[model samples]
Target: MDIRIGMLGFGFMGKTHAYAVENLKYFYKNLPFTARITALCTAHKDTSCAACAEYGFDRACGSEDEIISDPDIDAVDVCTPNIFHYETVKKILRAKKHVMCEKPLAVTYEEAAELARLADEAGVTTQIVFNNRYMAPVLRAKQLIDSGRLGDIIGFRSAYLHNSCMDPNKPAGWKQTGEYGGGVLRDLGSHAIDLVYYLCGDFERVSGKSLIYYRERAGMDGAVWKTTADEAFYITAQLKSGAIGTIEANKLTVGVNDDLSIFVHGTRGSLRFSLMDPNFLEFYDGSLPGGDYGGDRGVTRIECVNRYPEPGGVFPGVKAPVGWLRGHVGNMYNFCSAVYEGRQAAPSFFDGARISAVIDAAERSDRADGAFVAVAQP
Candidate 1:
């Protein structure tokens, strides 16, 4: 049985979902069911329809409802704008379909919680597509942390710094507004928080600041749009495990490539992971004696394996030297299989909702001038 996936949204996330659908069977073994890109949906009829044809979708749907109501599709992958996630996801779940939505779950905390609740109530399986968790090196890092190789983590730093849209002339879209999921915290910090939870434990508290680097930008309609959201975020958090950490993300970083690195100092050792060097993880063990020796503290490259099942080719695995693009594809296969087979999925919507709550707490803390705020654990 192949799980039929209908992807909605044809932008960055749309193409990513499509790529994942197009490459699911090339990596793993024993997928409970086969997966296929059954359809594509977008608000625009022509552009979306063209994308559907170009991407080899079986068909193109004109509306989110059209895709959700299509019984032939087993799941609807939502890559649409964050402001639309809550309503879109609520309807999809009501249609008794599984979903793999982009991060934040919703543009606002209330909406996120409602969507999370609805997904849970529907019991139809859902994931928020925290794709970083699927990164091979990140997985290896988790394994190392679980083994206590990093010892008792005393301090941690996870930052996602990139310079993709630093220019004022970059124009305004859904991401530039404060209300429409338009902020640095929700846009990028969500991933950081999720990574924090994945690598370490839940957050005990977080206190930080978020700033909108640019005040305004050109709109698609050649009008000036307010850039009320932060282009960067700076936050310090306390993990429930007693480890304090800093999580920062900036779109203003010059010459950055989606750099997400976590530095940890433990009681006995330390380890680090940078997304640019996705293949290898770096670890320094203080337990080993060093007698006046000069050693390199460079990060070790642990290439990712991209072997997947039939039709899921080039999917993410232990293969080192893999890229973030492959991880996106692998994530689709994971969620689709989990939905069809009635099993587990990584970074489920609950994880999404929880991280959203963390962001909410951070916002509260920011309002209070960087006071500690406890994160709710599910």
Candidate 2:
């Protein structure tokens, strides 16, 4: 099978997705289908054409409509901004094409729920880009939890932090504006939320607080502008299983670069993972007997670097230190494999909608002065 993709937007994420598609063969051995970006579209025709020429796409589309209407394109990859997701993904579903979308599904829960409904009705393979879930350590974490290694998750604390918002002189892009559905909650919080949901379970209630440290910042054109988005967000949530946890997503932290970390404590054992230390997953098994000198009782570092199951871990060797890009590659590969096998992808639109619901509840809680709000089910 040959899966020709029509990719929307040519920004940083666009380039990342393209790299994932182009490098799939090298990372995964014996792929059942070949996939490539056949058509590219962006906000500007010139930029699209230039990207096509430079990246070897077959054609440059004047608009997303051209990509959606094309007959040869089997799937549409939505790498556009958060504000564009609802409309663009709706059209892709209407066209009966498979879709791979970036995080946070949409700006609002209503839109995300509708998208989830449409995706289910369309009966086409769809995937949300929760790339962190594809990391070997994350995958291992899921396995251990599923195997009851961590019995009855009691609590968890997760954080995704960055230093981009620390400087007041920095220009405010779409990410700092409310017009584009940009905020720390939607940008970094979505990943943190999804990981907890994936590992722990469904959320029951949440209390949230949003902070905007820099009310004003330089605009894209170097003009003074008021920041309309939250620079940091904090959430205290309770899962349906009675497990409670705290999630913190912020861009204002000092001396941090993609410092996403999570600690889950359960009755039997606990799990810890950090993006900065991506090569290993720390696991503490309480079931082990403890004696003097801490006999076989402590955190065990499981080397997960590039140690993917069969078909993967073929290229770059299994011992190679896994980087951030590897997660994207694995995510892309999973989506392609699902499409090739005529199966629903993991982290589907429903999962995205669920996460959207959690974010919606968090935002509501924030508006109510950090009052607890129930997470609505889609």
Candidate 3:
């Protein structure tokens, strides 16, 4: 049975999610159940129409409530903006429909927590899209950690840097305004935090430095504007497992896919994953006998595996079809599976809320000049 889907918000993430859900059947014929974009939502009819036409959504609506309230929508996929996540999800849950929302589930920990409670009461499954967890190298890293190959993790470092907002003249978008819940920390830091939790377990505390490198930038109306949001973050965390790690994210890097890569070391071994080369993972085993004569550690490639309705030539993470939605594709697949089978997937609302709290804690630490703050639960 094809799971009918209604997509909310049709911008970058919306388009991406639409692409994933639409082509899901092509990638995995045996998907526990199929999914189709039965409807779409955007803030305006023109935008919604354009997106529906471009993305092949069966129908489009200008308002979120309209789409969520529609009986035809089996599940609501919220992709509007960070600010809308909490409320839209609330309505969807109250309507007794599953929800698949983007990361950093809510603007604040309090909001996230409340939504989680409501979802439980609504008896519906909810998932936050932490797509990076589906990436090949990252997934392999998780497997190694789960297998205890990287024993007694001693230290770790990771960062997601990019040049998207480097231009001081770049006009403000929803991402640059605090009211819209825009900022590098919550906008991009959520992925990094979730990646850390997925591979290293829970964290005890976080200390951070968040900077708005551009105090002012051109506004949407071509006027200079003061910025209230962070452009980058430098964070340090101490995991509950006794491992120390650093995570950084920036949208103003001069030129690069800087956001890719995490280097990890343990008392016994080490691991490395880079988004630049999404296909490979490096590993080192200190206990491997007679390794002194050879190299201490080496890199291994993780072929892009996928699940099966395969357009059959080559696709990323082909080994796991669900992983195909990694960036958004695998994420959508997981969300659909959760909706269809009544299964709760990874990075649930509680998880998203927790990560938001972590970011909030980091931001608080940043304001206090890098004070170490406890990473409280949501």
Candidate 4:
């Protein structure tokens, strides 16, 4: 089967998705379906045309409507801004086409939930871009946790930090403003929250605090502008299993580049993973014997570099170091395979909605001055 895709937006993530789709054949052997971006759509026709010519897309479209209405497009890949996701996804779902959406499904939980509903009604394969979940080490962590190696998750700490917001002189993009539904929590926190939720469990309640250290920054146009989004967000959440954890998402931290780390502790064992050090997962087997010299009780670093199962790990030889882009490739492969196999994707629209619920609860807690807010069940 050829899964012809109509892609919306051509920004960083859009290019990333294109790379993943174009490279899937090299990463996964014997892929059941071939997928490609058949059409490209952007806010401007000229930009879209240029991207199509440069990136080998079949055609360029001026608006999303053309892509959504095209019968030849079997799937729609949405890499647009946070603000446009809700409406664009709604149309694609209505068209009964498969969808692959980026993180924080929508600006609000209500919108995310609505998209989830439409996705279900459409009966089309859907996936949310929680790319971190597809990493080799992260996947290994999930396996251990599911096998009860982590026992009952007692606590966890996850954080995604960047240095983008540290300099006040830097020009603010759409991500630093509420007008485009951009906030550190929604941008980075969603990934952190999803990681914990994916490894640990569903959140029961949460308390959150937001910080905007630099209230003013230069806008994209070089004019002085007041920031309306949180530069940093902190959340204390309890899972339904009674495990409590803290999640931090900030862009103001200095000297960090795409640093996302997570530690989960349980009664039987513990797990640690850092995006900066993506090739290995640190695991402590509590069941191991402990001698006077600490014996085998110490943490063991499991090398998970490109160690994906059969069909995968074939091109890269499984020993090659895995990087951030590998996760995107894995995510795209999963979505395409699920669509081909007539199955639901793992991180489906429902997962996106659930994560949005957690974000919604955290935001409400922030508004209430860090009071505990119950996460709405999706």
Candidate 5:
């Protein structure tokens, strides 16, 4: 099977997805299908045309409709702005095409829910780009949690922070504007919320607070403008399984760069992971017997590294250190494989909608002066 993707948007995520598709075979041996980006669609025609020629795409499309309606396109890979997701995804599903959408599925829960429903009715393979879940250490953490090593998860704290938004003089992009759904909450909070929800259970209730440390900043056009979105978000949530934790996403952190870390505590053990230390997982076993010499009571660093499953691990070797991009590759492989096998992918639109619902609830909570809000069911 040849899984040809129609790539929308020629930005950061576009390049990332393209790299993932182009390099899948090298990392995963004995792939069941050949996956490639066959068409390119961008905000500008010239750039799209140039991308097609440079990246070996067969065609350059002026609009998303061209790619969505293309007979040769097996899937629509959405890497466009947050504001474009709902409509683009609806059209792709209406066309009966598979979709690989980036995170925070839609700007609102209603839109996300409708997309999830449409995907289900279409019976098309779908995946949301919660790429962090593909990290080896993160996967290992899931394995341990499922195995009951961290018996009955009770609490967790996770945060994703960056310092890029701290400088008021820096020109802002679409992400810093409210109209395009730009904000740290939806940008980074979506990941943090998903990470916790993936390990913990469904959210029961949440209280959230948003802050805008820098009220004024240069807009995309370099004009001084008032900030319309949050620079940081703090959330306190209760899970359906009776666990409670704090989740945060902040861009005003003075000295942070792609820093995402999580600490999960349970009845029997605890697990810690940091994106800064991509190769290992820190685990502490409360079940370890106490001794006068403190025998085996300390945290053990498990070297998860690039230890992907068969068809992977071989390229970089299991012992090799994997970086952030490895997760994207793994995520792409999973989606493509599911499509080829005619199976629904994990982290599907359902997962995306659920996360978006939590986000919506959190925003409402922020507006209500940090009052608790219930996450709506999909």
Candidate 6:
């Protein structure tokens, strides 16, 4: 099977997904299907044409609609701005094609819910790019939780932080403006929220606070502009399973670089993960025997890096240190395989919509002065 993808947005994630599709064959030896980028579309025609020439895409489309409606394209990969996702995803699913969207599926819960409903009705293969979940450590974390190793999860904490917004002199990009659906909460919080939901369970209620430490900053044009988006957001949540946790997203951390970490504690054991140390999952087993000298009671660092099951971990040795981009490759490979095999991919748009619903509640809590807000069900 040949999976022809028409990708929108030639930004950071757009290029990443393109690389995944192009390199999947090398990472996973297969006798099943071939996935390739057949077309490219971006905000600017010149950029799209240039990308086509440079990246060897078959067609340089004028708009996303052209790519979505094209019969030759089997899948529509959405890597556009958050504001554009709802409409573009609807168009893709309505065209009876597969869709692979980046996180925070849409700017609002209502829009994401509608998209999820339409995707279900269309019965098309869909995936949301929560690439962090594809990390070997995260996968192992999920396995341990599911197998009752982290028995009866009681509480958890997660954070995703960056220092990109720490410098007041730095110019504001689309991510620093509210009109573009830009904020650390929506950008980083979405991933953090999904991590808790994925590991623990559905959120029952939440209280949130948003902060803009730097009220004004340099604009994209090098002029001073008011900051309209949150530099940090703090949320405290309760899960349906009676677990409570804190989730935080911050862009004003002075010396952080993509710092995402999570800790989960349970009655039986605990698990910890940090993107800084992406190759290992530190697990604590309370069931283990403990003595005065702390015999076999300390945290066990599980070497999970690059140890993917069959079809993966072949090109790169299993013990090799895996980085962030490897997760994107695995995510894309699974989505394409799902499309080809007529199966639903993990982290579907429904999962994305769930995070949107939680975000909606978080915003409500923030507006209501941190009053607990119930998460809307899908």
lDDT tens digits, residues 1-378, model 6?
Answer: 999999999999999999889989888877499999999999999999999999999989888999988999999999998989998998899899999999889999999999989999999999999999989899999999999998999999999999889888989988888888899999999999999999998999999999999888898888989998999999999999999999999998888898999999999999999999988999999999998899879899999978888787786767567665668779999999999999999998999999999999999999999999999996
Listed per model in order, the count of residue pairs whose N, CA or C atoms clash below 3 Å is 30, 0, 19, 0, 0, 0
In model 5, the Cα lDDT at residue 15 comes to 96
After superposing all C-alphas onto the true structure, candidate 4 shows an RMSD in angstroms of 19.7
- Report every candidate's CA lDDT: 0.80, 0.94, 0.81, 0.94, 0.93, 0.92
Off by over 4 Å in 6: 323-378
Q: Of the candidates numbered 1 and 4, which has the greater TM-score value? A: 4
Model 1 / residue 23 / CA error / Å: 1.1
lDDT ranking of the models: 2, 4, 5, 6, 3, 1
Q: Could you give candidate 4's per-residue lDDT for residues 43-129 as a string of tens digits?
A: 899999999999889999988999999999999999999999999999999899999999889999999999999998999999999
lDDT of 4 at 300: 96
Task: Output the lDDT of residue 222, model 2.
Answer: 69
- Measured on C-alpha atoms, candidate 5 has an lDDT of 0.93
How big is the positional error of residue 28 in model 3, measured in Å on the Cα after superposition?
Answer: 1.6
- Residue 152 of model 1: what lDDT? 87
Give the worst 10-residue stretch by lDDT in candidate 3. Answer: 307-316
Q: If scored against the real structure, what TM-score would every candidate get?
A: 0.78, 0.85, 0.79, 0.85, 0.85, 0.85
Q: In candidate 6, where is summed lDDT lowest over 10 consecutive residues?
A: 317-326
Candidate 1 regions exceeding 4 Å error are 294-320, 323-378
Indicate the TM-score of model 2. Answer: 0.85
Prediction 4 TM-score vs. true: 0.85
